[model samples]
Target: MILTDIVSRIYVLNLPERKDRKKEIEHALKQIGIHWQANQVICWPAIRPSSNNNFPSVGAYGCFLSHVAALQDACHAEHGWALILEDDAVFASDFNTQLPELAKVLSSEQADLIYLGHCHVASETAAPAGLNISTAAVIGAQGYLVRIAYLATLLPYLEACISRPAGHPLGGRLHYDGALSLFRQFNPSCRTWIAQPSWIEQRFSRSDIQAHWWYDRWPLLRQCAAWARKFKQARRHAATLN
Candidate 1:
């Protein structure tokens, strides 16, 4: 019901082989003084043959499963809400100060999905803490919140998506982030919201799933890429109202 309560049950989706990400996530949480559980990321090698061909690639399917794994656990947590984070997630400079108000927004609005961090589409306005409603298509899964009630429906939707391909009018593909947005689109009853100035952002990393070796590997390039990302986000944020 409060920020402390939300922080207590955070789940970080991470690949077992990526100890680098694991340690980095731990350090990030430490700075915010929060606790977390590392949910091991699912790998393509372990994927079922039938579902293997469903997604665009092995990495995409793996990412889908990792998020599903986290949702499965979070759906059954003692609390009615769950906060899910990817290992590469970077908190906003003011995340801690703003987080406490989230519980109130969650309670009053009864949002099915709350994007603590997101990308592609920026928040439309400088809405107050409890009022940043998502109006357009959004992407990124670096961090978000899930309501237990919605998770019950979400898990099943995801199960059905395994055989569906991305960009399907009928909710195809299991790429976690895209599917989530699709879920909202198809399920009109599901209410989704975003925390403006986003609570977290996915940092530059040679992703375990997506390709970008130059930016994810070299420190200078990574730093530059990070800057570029910031600039893009700022531009989107500014242009949202126009």
Candidate 2:
């Protein structure tokens, strides 16, 4: 599949110092026939804590900011849709084939956001082929496609957070992905979904922000617990629907 034909604009978030990670992503893209361009790399800002306890950690804050930067660019760009990817994203072997199909589905449905990859913890069950739209339960901003029209609502909400002083009630409560989930809940027009059998996976790398010993030592157990929580939530949601 021709990537440019599917989505004209693609942005990858990377820190300036992480040239190695940039190179790795570029090489992987080339293997999939995507020509890596320097301009495609969005330089992530330096990590710094807010004066108050708005953000959970400097790294989380920086990660959130990087996503905002990508959204701002998408709002400014001419394309109707844009694909945003993190530098550490590992593409699946069939990414080229699957992504174009996903794009077509999103366009036909006028989807607001579709996660191309996500953590399995709290993951919802996959939708069947040809009908992939569903209310997302967990969202990992590692790789996603966003429609520019949705950014019309999203930008103002983010800008409001930007205007607030640190320690404000809403200042740092939401990470980027969390913000998206909330937006979908409050905005009746907003629609979102996850692509089943994610087309990408996050590469195992030491996080530049917050560090947790348990995540490092017992990753599988942590993921299992997450899934358990998701299943419980799903049951509750189903009961409500009935």
Clashing residue pairs in candidate 1 are: 164-173, 165-173, 206-216
What 10-residue stretch in candidate 2 is worst by lDDT? 44-53
Candidate 2 local Cα displacement, residue 225, angstroms: 25
TM-score of each: 0.76, 0.74
In terms of lDDT, which candidate is strongest?
1
Q: Tell me the lDDT of candidate 2.
A: 0.66
Candidate 1 whole-model C-alpha lDDT, 0 to 1: 0.68
Model 2 regions lying over 4 Å from their true place: 38-53, 121-126, 129-131, 162-172, 212-242
Per-residue lDDT tens digits for candidate 2, residues 1-242, read: 65656664678788778776687778766767877554443444433445423666666677777777778877776556778888877776667767567767756856877778777425445466432666656567788888877787877777666556545555434566766665666665767767666666666554555564465457797566556654764564455346
Per-residue accuracy of model 1 over 106-225 as CA lDDT, tens digit each: 667568788888876644555675436665567888888788767778889887787666666777675678888878778878777877666787765557666456655788987787
